[model samples]
Target: MTTNVLMTVPTGPGVGLTSVSVGLVRALEQQGLKASFFKPIAQPHPGDEGPDRSTAMVAQGSSLRPVEPIPLHEAERYLYNDNIDELMEEVVGRFQASVDNDSTIIVEGLAQIPGHPYATRLNKAIARTLDAGLVLVTAPNDMRVQDLEHHVEIAAGSYGGIKAHDVIGCILNKTIPGSLGAKSYGDQFARRPIFKRNFALLGQIPVAEELTYPRVKDVAEFLRARIINAGEMDTRRIQSYTLCARGVENVLEALRPGVLVFTPGDRTDVIMATAIAALNDIKIAALVLTGGYEPSAALIALCGKAMAKGLPILSVESNSWDTAIKMQSFNQEIPLDDKERILNVKEHIARCIDHDWINSFALNHEERKLSPPAFRYRLIEQARALNKRIVLPEGEEVRTIQAASICAERGIARCTLLGKEEEIRRIAQNNGIELNHGVEILDPDSIRERYVAPMVEIRKHKGLTDIVARELLQDQVVLGTMMLEQNHVDGLVSGAVHTTANTIRPALQLIKTSPDSSLVSSVFFMCLPDQVLVYGDCAINPDPSAEQLAEIAIQSADSARAFGIAPRVAMISYSTGGSGSGNDVEKVREATRIAQSRRPDLLIDGPLQYDAAIMEKVAQQKAPNSKVAGKATVFIFPDLNTGNTTYKAVQRSADVISIGPMLQGIRKPVNDLSRGALVDDIVYTIAITAIQAGSIGA
Candidate 1:
């Protein structure tokens, strides 16, 4: 009976959960449909007092009902016995009343639907309860393919060996536009009949500024309007057009072909010249009439005739060009396959959303094609195929041990722990965390044999000796990385209880660069439910020279492509297109130029304010010809100070979730994790590591 479009996103570890969710909400809302979002399980930090922080913000930004967030703990109380039905009943009861009288409701799931004790049951229950259609949002990186296939297997299997209806379709998030290899992944899913039958491709949302970071240009494009009482003009023509007041004949004379005429609609002199230019085949394409009034009847008739001959007219009601520009610069560009189909999107929600869809998905099915058990096994098999050795550096911790045990129990990896063997065993036993059978326990002392040789090799290159290698190898982080490079392990993870420098230095000294890379860069896959937003050089290279920034942009864009994100890059700065002048602007401009020259294959804009990069209105005002403005996915910051502060500010202030500072341009496996990383961090690092290993061959 609820008019809300009940939507759910099923997630797993290393997936871009929030990114997909954010993009989906944006896309749905662009159609004027009211939509709401909910997070079933919000991981609470040690001293947090708020609701699921990410979910809370999503709900706030969404077009759905604006309900106060229920604290995670309070929500848990209603999950009595962790029953799926109980939780759904409570959520619906609590949220139903607060939602708009008519709006769509979206539910965001935690990573790995089955990883949590009650996840499997909760997913199905909510699906059935809301009668919502399931949209399985997956990250499109190399590791993501395995994850997708794994999800497919689980859907075919049981929620817990019990059968139920599974997800209906998939939205391939952060997909690169021209990456044929990535695009071919659709065929891989098609090979599986169950997934093929259930999987509908809603669309692949690429990495772009419009979705990743709010850019001013995107806003400009969105708010722009055609000064009307005239005929049809070309959108492309208006793209590069500059607006000048009617009396400013000097400015008009100085203008080029893409200039917009701004005047009262009754200004016959301006209209006649513009029309004559078009008739004479002048390149002039657009005009902006101010004063909030239409042209005289005679002028309208003439304009109507011109429109019949193909000169488009746009009407604006603002009195001044500045006012018109300001008013027209507040909207965003909403891209759908067909803008006209937005109505259908709303109707689809109205007709298809119902109780049957929700109930069917909620029941636990053992025979479901993509059962959790199958997904786990599939990842394990994929790991084997890659010959990747999964290392649990924080194995002494309870969470790490549990994760280790799970991986080992599933035969997904050859697991290793960082602490002493005895200490690991004691901690696992005391904490009731099972250390799976044959899980390898390695102490810093034991890894010496495996790492010493690689350390020696690195030292030898530096004109040092075996003695120095032994001393550095004594450092666990260094030794761990050395172990990986030496083939003692295929990957490594350390950062929890260690500094970024400590975690990364070892790899930097040993693993070095990829064959073609000159310098290393860092990026984060800000995974939303329907998209993966990539941010680059936000971690390393604090004040890179223009050349370095360009390299960073190129590297980030490539990394995005590898992850199936279409790389529309925005070189963000305080100034936009020389609008505001400064050394910083110059740096960004140079970086943009270099990046365009370097890649040539990518869409990029520089000296753009954040809003201009992603917002339509801003895009129109500045950098009109820019393909990247208002649609960039890869945001290359001017400097580390700005990049770090901006990313953090967006995370803290805007309530946006950031996923990485993923190390790039490295020759082999070398990644840094946040000091306050959770289990999910380790999982993503492993995923990135796996992808890095594979990228060598690629």
Candidate 2:
């Protein structure tokens, strides 16, 4: 398994590295991509610089496996001896040992701390050695909204410019909430022009108010006070501490759940005030004595009901001022058992990230080779062997002329350009195209009469009208379809300047659906960097019924098999399994059942979400114990609305190339090209048409 690594390098010591790491893992998992976590060298845990809590926290928190880190001292010793190469060797070796194939691994880098003088240099070197993509994790601690971006710009320089391909993006941690420049977190939305630059802002985690409080148990331990009444010590969390040296009348107003009170033990009024609130069920966290003060026997007796109601009171041995200063220094750090908060943090931060970028990153990694698909190689080979004649209706269109020229030159097909011979020649000459053998430029004017009688005969059922047939023959697409009906051309490809209706209307009238097919559907061969996937009914059905959808699914599976793509058909829907329901989901479910029952030979499953269909990790969680859940290659959308939108989104987001809406089930091959298709797209559509032409006879 060749491992792909994304090393998350922090800007400094406290950038919420663990929180960011946990959230990132969850985000990837939510997208159905498998991600693992690794900390190469341990960093400081709160109050101690030993035994990493980040690894332990994430390991316990997520299902993803986390590799334990080498002790910081051992790693630093290598730096001290200047044997950086050996240290890198150790890091990479240990990292690769834990690697899994086709899964992304997130390596947490050493923080830029006072202790680790070579942390930055080591991080870059380790990243380079591992051939890892770098993701910068930053925190705007003291830097204002305007200045925070400069830190990212500076840190990214160590790796490369921000736009460098290996620099994945940046994740901003501990962001203050509010409007931009409004103190803490502001208008840092995960929108375009993210971060006021071209910098990729993957996520911006808001400062959570919940993380500000330490558990009451932790506070009790830190203060080293005797717990006279240990009410809800382990369960209760406290923040917003107040030195309640004032009278009961003033302090009573602030008594609330999570507010810690510090008052003199002799302040019976304050104690009574707290007891009153407790009796009223205000849920005050705890009451602490400052300056070694403890209440008298009568006071303790009086507060028995309050203590029973679970209000903790602690007596400390320091002066009020001294205890106040110590409490002020206490930190609000995460404890291991707070699973609910940990999960919430993961979900919150995951929601903040730009999922589109992460999905693209995952897809890019999945198909990183960036080579022509094997199916494409097969396309040219098969089309060339058949040597079929492909008729282009939009011959005068610039792109069509170039495509026909290429087809003729490469022997991909015998090209028949239906346009004015002289006009076609002039257009080719102006475009610097030297056209030659296997290319036939027919003047549609001369051929218009030859196809009029055939058109009239074919459409005579609609209405016998020679006048109408001649008028219809003026349309190049109608002319092309008529030529295919009479076996004058092996295939017809149009729609470069026409709508889908224009391309199909003529075919339906003349060369309609083959006897073996009930419905005429279309599919696009999406070319990823490594492989090809077939998206079906995208350009054809708007909202097919369950029965028609089944037929479409079966036809798509057959088409994919014909095109050399293994057909594990996934019936795509908005939900996975029984997780969602509605008319939409029910349609997909019925389609899957009908298709599976009709074509038992095909591997088919449905009501699968986009991620469940392609990603094994998500499949395992969402639709596990089912066949064709994760390894589906051919996707049958329930309707055209979903199919078209999803295909375009995936194509643009993943930077994929797609060909066709190659009209299937037509007796003779007919395909449509997008208006915005390039010359190369037309050429491939021609090849696909030729292949379809061959499939008809076979």
> What would the C-alpha RMSD of candidate 2 be, to one decimal place?
22.9
- For model 2, how does the per-residue alpha-carbon lDDT over 289-356 read when each residue is reduced to its tens digit? 87777688888999999899888999888877788899767866666666556656776677667777
lDDT per residue as tens, model 1, 398-485: 5566556655654445667877888787666533356766478888776586566656766785786777778876677777777677
Cα error of candidate 1 at position 329, Å: 58
Reference-based lDDT, each prediction: 0.59, 0.79
lDDT of 2 at 478: 89
Q: How much lDDT does candidate 1 score?
A: 0.59
TM-score of 2: 0.51
Where is model 1 more than 4 Å wrong at Cα? 1-387, 392-394, 406-414, 527-531
Clashing pairs in 2: 176-184, 176-185, 177-185, 178-185, 178-186, 179-186, 180-187
